[model samples]
Structure formats: structure tokens, C-alpha cells
Target: MSGHLDAVLARVDAGLEQSLERLYALLRIKSISTDSAYKAECQRAADWIVGELKGIGFAAEAHATPGHPVVWAKGAAQEGPHVLFYAHYDVQPVDPLNLWRSDPFEPTLATDAHGRKIIVARGASDDKGQMMTFIEACRAWQAVTGSLPVTVSLMLEGEEESGGKNLPPFMEAHKTELGAADIALVCDTDMWNRQTPSITTMLRGMVGEEIEITCADKDLHSGMFGNAARNPNQLLAEIIASLRAPDGRVTLPGFYDDVAEVSPEIKAQWQGLGFDEAAYMAQAGLSIPAGEADRSVLEMLWARPTCEINGMIGGYTGDGFKTVIPAKASAKISFRLVSGMVPEKIRDAFRKHVEAMIPADCSVRFTSHGGAPAITVPSDGTYLQQALRGLSDEWGTPAVITGSGGSIPVAGDFKRILGLDTLLIGFAQIDDAIHSPNEKYDLDSYHRGIRSWVRILAALAV
Candidate 1:
């Protein structure tokens, strides 16, 4: 097996330029899903991926959706474990276009200040570059051995940047076929650093709620109804203030009931990651850590639940003061949940907390955006252990297990609908600038990411 993998790595090294040309071809499509003008471009990008998969001997096709099309494919059946791989073809809109140094759709290579070669283009690091790494690896494997080590199925989405509302239903529609895989792989996350590879083993889930508080049926003059009529703005502000404690804990009843502590070994690993909280804060123009008083920054981010106020709106003075008590106020709030917390329970607890604070003359309404439970991959799983070793072998550095602070709805969907946990391993660095102007993917990242996947596929060939 080692000798076979060596041949695949050699094939990847020899075909590096050809692989990049393929990536450039896909990147050149203006597949911006958010903008209705680029709808055809998204379809074109999906077809391109399906064509590339066909070239690599995979049975691939582009399927229709209400939004952009999804490209689904499957390789020849193999004796190794079956794995489902996921990525997105749609890129974010290029707003403030002047900020980009070059055409967002025209991929090019440039030397960065760090003297490293980088590929500059929209969707380069966000996913086009990352997605190609996996495909190129499979291409190399097929070029060398004429077959994949694992039974591979791919779900290349076209609406990830545009909220990905169609993906869950798509997966649900193809549940048995897509869920037959023993595990899933996603190439949409980042490495811990350029040299240190990391697999995101956990992701925080979320629930969004918008609350509107109505105090009076209509606006009242402050002079005539002063101290007589209720003010929803003040009432909303007070309720928001009461949601958290001075020590940075959410005050919702039972909020902490399902929260679990990070294992000792996991906590030790995070401590060893040497994350600089001061530098993290300085990047945001802040001077202090603001989460749980007793927790480390990583712990607060990866292991704890949080209640955040996203936006608020109330009485307004367009040009000058209105001198009136507003009839209603509204705010959008979200809760970041951990492994054991249920989204519905948290929503209920929050509504209960807010309703308890309403005055006799006031009324409140709650609007649920959506919610998903947190996802955690077992640390002791065989596939995870094998992939970690494979990554370490390719990078010459031990891969670390990390956690994401944000939710990935697709991962939740996979777990919810397919009963398969996902291994999110990607080679993009933090400074890749995935969704911003001048987005790039390190040349070395692209080249070695292919090699890493080759090794992982070989290792998983049980």
C-alpha cells in the first residue's frame, strides 16, 4: 500500500501544473450564487466539475435545483470504506470591486510578501482551489492504480455562499444513496497554520430568534403621557441586559444544563495550540477577553454556549428628536449551542425568559429563523485516527484536532439526515482571505493538499 501511495504522490507532483490549469478553468466562471445575474454561470461551474469528474473516471452528472444546480458523482465500487466528499462551487459576490487587485474571475499566480507563490482569484481559497485538491488527488490515484482506494461519492453544491437552503432537502431526497458511505469528508475549512494540519472535530450549532416587543398600541407624546405610558425600547433594552450575567454566562434557565466540559486531553491540546488572545483581540481593536471569566479564549469559543444580540431597532429620529415613546421595539438575537443542547429547548427557554419580563400593558412576539444541534466527531473513531496519521505522514507534522466556533449547516444536515459524521480537513490557511477581495490560495497549499488527500485515501483503504 505504501509503495502504491508513493506512485500516486509522484503522479500528483508530475501533474501539478495540469491540476492547476483545471482549477483555473473552474475559477474563471463567474458563479456568484447570490446575484441573480450569474445564475447561468453557476450552472456552468457545476457542469465543469461534472465534466472533470468524468475525465477522472467517475460517473458524474449535474442535477437541477430551485437555485443553482448540484453536481453529484460516484467512483467505481472498491473494497475499502465508502466515503462521501462535499464541497461548494458557488462563490460570494464581489462587492466593492475596486478593492480587488485583479479580475476576480481570472485566476493568476503571484509572489506574496512572504516570498510564497499564491493563486489569486475569487473562490480560490473559499473552495474552488480546495475542492480541486480532492479531485486532483483522486485523479492521481486513478492515473497510477486505475481505481480509487475508497468507494467515493461527491456532493458538489452550488449555493453554499447564498445560504445553502436547498442542500438539506437535496440530501434528504437522496438520503439512501448519499448516506451509504461509512464517513463523509468536507474540504471547506482551514488548517491551524501553514505547517500544522488540523481536522475540525467539532462545530458549534446555532438558533436565531427575532423578538418584537409592543408596549403601547400607538406612539404617545412624552409630555402628555410621561410616566403614564409604557416604553417598549426601554423594556426591550432591560430584557436584553438581563439575558447575561456579569461573568459572561447566559442567564436563561437551564442554559448550562446540557453544556459539557471539554475533556482533559482535549483541553490540554488546546492549551498547547498557543493561541494568542491578546493578538486576537488586537485584530478586532479590542484590549481584553470578554467571554467566561474562568475559561480560556479557545474554550469559550469551541466549548461553551453563547447568547448574542445581532441587531436591534426601535423608535427613531430621522433628522431630529421625535420626543415620543415608541409603540414597539424589535431585536434579532442568536444562541450558539454546544453538543448536548437542543435548539428547540433553548428557543423555548429564551421565550420564557423574555415573556416573564413583559409588563401587564406590554406584549411580545417571537420569530424563529432556524436552528441546528452541534456536531462532534468521536476522537477515537478509526477513520479519524487513520486520516490524522495520513495527514501527519504527508505534512511531516502531527495533525491536530480543532473545533470551529461557527455552525456548518451541511455538517448538521449530514448527521441529521444521513447518520454519518464528517471529517472537515482542508489545507487553506487563515490569511487565505477566502471571501474577501484579492482572495488567494497558497501554491504550496494546493500542491501539498493533493498529496495529503492521496495519503488519506490510501490509509482509509481498509
Candidate 2:
């Protein structure tokens, strides 16, 4: 093992140029899944991945999906704590493209204001660059030691930017091949800070619902109806308003029934990180807390369940004002739930709340989108400890455990379908501009990321 580790490190140091070239080739594919015009580009990216994996002596293929293809690969001798590595080949659409300093598809190396060298491209840091970190690490191992420290199955989906509809079915069909993993390695999260590595301990769940309220057969003239007819717009607004109180507590009965309070130890850990609430608000051009009265800003974001009105439409929204109450009013609402809160229960409670708020003259219709429950990994897991020790050894800092406010549905799916716990470790930072204009990945991040994964693999294999 010591000799193999030495050989892998030597290979990584020698393959730096080849690694960057491969990343550049991948960045040139323009695999934007959300855009129909880029369908072929998505396939091209998948094909490229297949070639890369096969070049590394893995049996790889690009399997067709309804929208895009998923690149699947497996190394030889699949035994001994096999790991399923998950990543996405698809990148977000580069709209508002003019904001970028260079073409989003044209990868470039540049230095940032902080003197950190970075890779500028559409999917540079989001998944492509991050995924390559692990892949390149494995490549180094295979090139030097002739095999990876552990058996690995690589699954790179081309539709993560869109909903991963094809993934669940694919996993079901290939359960024997994909489900043999003892654990999953997910490279989709960020470090706590530029210098501080983070292992994401929790991820908030999500529930989305679209509600439509109808009060009349057709649009009613305000002057003609006056107070005679009911207005669905008013009813819908009132119902939404009633969901949350002025103090930011959700007003639905039993809404907090299953919510677990933040532990004092965890709270102290978060406090010690020295999060600047005022600075965070200032960046968003605000000055007041919009969450529960007693909770800190960090707690509000990472621990609390929130009711948010994603979108709403009613009456006339065109150029001219129309003095008529529309027959129907519709809204798209969502909830970010923490651990212990079931999405089904929340959806049911929301439906009940809307129904109870509706007048006899009005009718309410609810449509629920799919949802997943929150997840929290035990901090003391063996894999997590290995990750912490590896990252600390590589970066010279203690790794932090943090929770993200957003949902990563695939993480939940991995736990449900494969019964595999995922370790969320990556080198992306908070200001990487992922899913936004001018996305980038720091060059130092890309280089050190490879080294970090090397150390992690070595630790895990031990």
C-alpha cells in the first residue's frame, strides 16, 4: 500500500498538464441539458466521458435516456467496499451570456482579484471540474498502481440540471450492477470557506405545490359584481398570508410538530465559525432578519423549515389595467424542510390549511410536485472520519461540518434506493457563481482538489 501510494502521488504530479487538457476538452462540449438545441452537445459530452473512462481501462458506455445519455463505467475486480461515484455531465444554460468576460464555452485560465488562478467556463466548477478531480485522482492510481485502491462504479448523468427523471429508473434496472456499493461519493457541495474544508452533514428537503382557486365561472366585472361576487384573488392571498405569522413562525397547525430543535453544541459550533449576518444581509441589500425572532441567521437558513411563495399570478398582468376580478388565481408555493419533517405530512397540512381557509363559494385545487425528506449524516461515521483526516492532512486545517439550505434530491435517492450513505466533499467555494453568470473554478482548487481526493482514497482504502 505504501509503495502504491508513492507511485500514485508521483503519477499525479506528472499528469497535471494532461489533466488540464482533458478538462479543457470536456469544457468545450457545451452540454447544456436545459436547452433543446444542445441535445447533441449533451450526447457528445457523454461520448467523450465514455472514451476517457475506456482509455483508463474501464468498461464504459453511454446509455440512452429519454432526454440525455448517462455515462456508466466500472473498473476491474469489483470487490472490497465498492464505491458508486456520482456526478453530472450537464451544465446550466448560459443565458445573460453577455455578462461573461469570455465565451462561456471557451475555457480559459485567469487570475482573480485575490491572485488565485481560476478556470473560467460554464460548468467549470459546478460539476465538470469537480468531477474531474476525483476521476483524475483515480487515473493517477490506475496509471501508477495498475488498479484503484477500491473498486469503483462511475455514474455521470446528463440531466441533473433538469430533474433526474431517468436516473431512478436506470438505477432500478441496473440494481445488481449499481447497488453493490458500500457507500457513495458525491462531489456536489462546497467547502465552508476558501481555507476551510467542509463535510456537509445535513441537507434541507423540499416540497413544491401549485394551487389554483376558482370563485366564478368566468371573469367578473368589478363594477357589475361589486360586493355581490366572490374574488378568488383575495381568497388566495389571504390563504397564503395565513400560512406564516408576522414573527416568521408558520401558522399552520402542527407545522412544527416534527421539527427538531438545534442542539446547543451544534449551535456553538456554528457560532464559532463567525458568520457575519449583517454582511450577508448587506450583500442582498437588506438590513433586517426575516426569520424566527430568536433564531440566528445561520439557523434560519440551515435548520428551520420555511414557507415561501415562489410565484403567484392573478387578475390582469399585461400592459393595460383591467378592472375585472379573474375567475381563477394561482400560486406556486414551496417549503424547505429540515430533518424530522416528512414532506408528505407537510403537503397534507398545507392542503388542509388552504381548504380550511377557503370560503364556501370558492373552490381550491392543489397539485403536488415530488418531494424528498431531509438528510443528516452521523459525524462519527468511519468514512467521514477518514475524509476529515485526509482533508486535514491535505489542507492543513480541521474540516468543518455544515448543513446546506437547499436540497440535493439524488442524495436522498442514494439513501433510499441503494441504502448507501454519501460523503459530500468538494473544493468549490460559496462565491463560485455556480448556476449563475460567469461561473468559474479556482485553479488552486482544481490542483489541490486532485491531491485531496488522492489522500481521501488512500485513507478510505486503509
Candidate 3:
């Protein structure tokens, strides 16, 4: 290890207890963004983060949004590349609180079956703990070297758990303030495995639409006008059925017109990882590949575009049964898009398809929820190399570049609004129970995460 990194690691080791205490203090705040009752706590959490950043010698402040506040901070300016760090201070609601062995807000240190020490709390692994890894690293640097090696801007949001409606506008308003960075470091993703470090390279985009079809002016009794009146539910089902073929491919014309095929190099790398398709299916209580017949599970999840019906409602779905031909039927649909596919184009094509299917007796109305396109960062960037090398130096294994199945909308916003690429790195594990009952962060992950950032900073400085 380099001498500078060794010094930073030493400082982190010396301050490990203090770091845990700070994390415990933040975890105690019930900053649940989805619940209006926790609004004050969210502000308190933002204030606490601001204080922590200020305490570490950064110029920090808590900026209010329409909902919760976002903590913005910056370290001393440097000549090298600047990195904008992003994470969330808010956590998911701790419902079914009876399931926890301890208070969700009162964090405790416990040992797991494998003898790994863990931090048990509400936001232990989701984000609070993960974000602290970077903060603690900065603290270590400030302690040992008296300043950060490279410049950093920290942006912690309190509305991530509530769909980040305020983040885009906030970014738009502060484009000049937030746009002075080459890349972003987002600590909201997970590693591929317990011992393996990963850098996420691709994220799927999302598009949502609500379609309502009206066939009759009013509901008619089945016994009275069942044969004469057309049922909108039947029409809705027919239209939905026509969207996909028996071969599992979407039937919409020009839907896959812009989708790019997965590169052979990526295919080979994914194959070498030896992903277990059966194991993944077993976890979800299934036995079949429900997507494209020829693609592997990894390809289907990481690279393919898909259409799914999120919800549908037509007739009465209440207590009993109503024998009536419903006047209107509605369905909510979403598409997961890959590279080269535009959300607006997909929305236009879908509207066209539905319009062509509508009969003379039926009328249709479409409501479009906004969407963002998919993004794939170059895997061979210098910052990525530095991060991978740093992680390898700390963990004795080269980091793997993987693709995330879910969308991080803020990432797209960063690229679109600010023209910044993001480096998604975090220490959360799959079984950490994020957004579920009994959330916990492994103590080992916390310790090594600080150490990892120490090395990453050193690498980036070089």
C-alpha cells in the first residue's frame, strides 16, 4: 500500500469507534420520507449531516426542498478531477416494527451466524450507513493529511425514498453550483457478492402510462343488455393480449427498432461469471425463464427491453360480484428500456398501437407519466480504473463491472442535466434487508468500506 493510504487507513482505524457512534446517532433519527409524520425527523437528519460535514472542515448547509431538505457540502478545492458524491439521508418506513429484535432507531452491534459483526438499525445498510463510509473517509483524510487529496462535493437528499420528485428541480435550479464536477460517486448500489467488489456500468430506464378505454356511456346490467352492449373489459384484455406474442417478444411495431444487441465481449464476461439461472428463479418461486427464449437470464435482466402490465381495473372488484358490463376499463403499463431506446418514441408508438386497436364504438384516453432513457457509462474510464485498482488493493480481487436491473433516475438526471457520469459503489449486500424488516449493515463492510475509500482517494489523487 502507498504511504499516504497507509496513513489514512491508520487514522480510520484509530477513529473506528467514533465513526460507529456517529453512525448510530444518525440512525437514531426516524427520517422516513414517505410518512408525513416524520417530516421533522427528516429535517433533523439533514441538519445532522450538515453538521457532520461542517465539523469535518467542509462548507456545508441544509437546503430545503418542497418536501425534505438536501444537505450540500464541499471540501477544499484541488487541481485534479472533482467528484460529486451522492447518497440519501432518508430511510424506508419501519413497518411491522414488532418483527425487529431491537428498536429500529436504536442501533446495536451484533454478531451474525458467521461471526461477522453487524450494525442493526432502520437505515443501517440502505443508505445512511453507506453514505457514512465516504464521510468517514473524508474525516480520516482531514485528520491525517489536514485536507482532502481531491475536491469533492457532497449532496445528500432526503426524498430518495419518496421517488426523488424534488431532486430534478433542485439540480436544475443549482446547475451552475452542481455542474462543476467531472463525475459523480453514488453510494446506493450493492456488491455482487460478500467478498466481491463491483462497479455498476448500466441502468435500465422506465416509462409508465395509463390507458383507459370507454365502450359505453354507462354501466349496463348483464341480465338486461349483456348481448347488445360491448364490454370494455373484454376489449382491454384483447388489446393487452395483442401486445405480446406467444414467443415472449413484445408485438408492438417498432418497439425493438432501436434496441442494440448485447456485445459479444459482454456476453463472454457474463458467461465467465457463471450466473446460476435456476438459483435466481428459485428465490422468486419460479422454474421457467419468462423472457426471450434464446437469451440468458443475465442478458434478459441486464440488457433486454420489456413491457409489463402493472395494474388493471375494469368491473367491480369490491366485496361481492356485480353482473354488469362496465362502461370503462383501465390499465397501467410500464416498459423497461435498454440502450438506444427513447422513452418518448416508445410512448408515441404505444399510443399509435392502442389507437389502431380501438373500435368505432370505443374511445380511448392515455395519460403519460414522465420517463428517462437508459444509460451505460464507459467501463474503461480512468476514474473507474482507479476505483477498481483501489478496491483490488484492499480486497485482493479485481472489481467486476456489472449492470443494475433497477433504475436510479437521478443518475440519468445527472447525465442529462449536468453532463456528469456516475460511479456507483456501495457496500450493501442482497440479504441486508434494505427497505424491509430487520435492516442491518455488516460491521466488517463498514470497516472495510472506510478503508476502501481511503485507498480510492489516494488512487484518484495519483
Better of 1 and 2 by lDDT: 1
CA lDDT scores, all candidates in order: 0.93, 0.88, 0.91
Tens-place lDDT per residue, model 1, 355-394, is: 9999987899999999999999999999999999999999
- Candidates ranked by lDDT: 1, 3, 2
> Model 2: per-residue lDDT, tens digit, 1-462?
445776777778888888999999999999999899999999999999999999888999999978899899998863356788999989999989878899999999988898888899999998999999999998998888788877888999999998989998888788777888877888988888888888887889999999999999999999999688888888888898888888889987888999999888888889989899999999999999896888889998999999999999998999978999799999999999998999999999999889988888789888888889888887779988888888888889888888899999888888878777888888997789999888999987888889888888888877
> Superposing all C-alpha atoms, what RMSD in Å does each candidate have to the true structure?
1.1, 1.6, 1.4
lDDT of 3: 0.91
**Top TM-score hit:** 1
Where model 1 places Cα greater than 4 Å from the true spot, the runs are none
lDDT tens digits by residue: candidate 3, 1-462? 246678889889988999999999999999999999999999999999998899989999999889999889999898788999999999999989888989999999998888889999999998999999999999999888888888989989999999889999999999998999888999998888888888898999999999999998999999998888889999999999988888888988898999989888877878877689999999999989887787788998999999999999998899989998999999999999987899999999899999999999889999988798898888779998899899888888777888987899989999999999988998888889998878999987899898888888888877
Question: Number of clashing pairs, model 1?
Answer: 0
Residue-level error in angstroms, candidate 3, position 244: 1.3
- What TM-score does candidate 1 get on C-alpha atoms? 0.98
Model 3: C-alpha RMSD to truth? 1.4
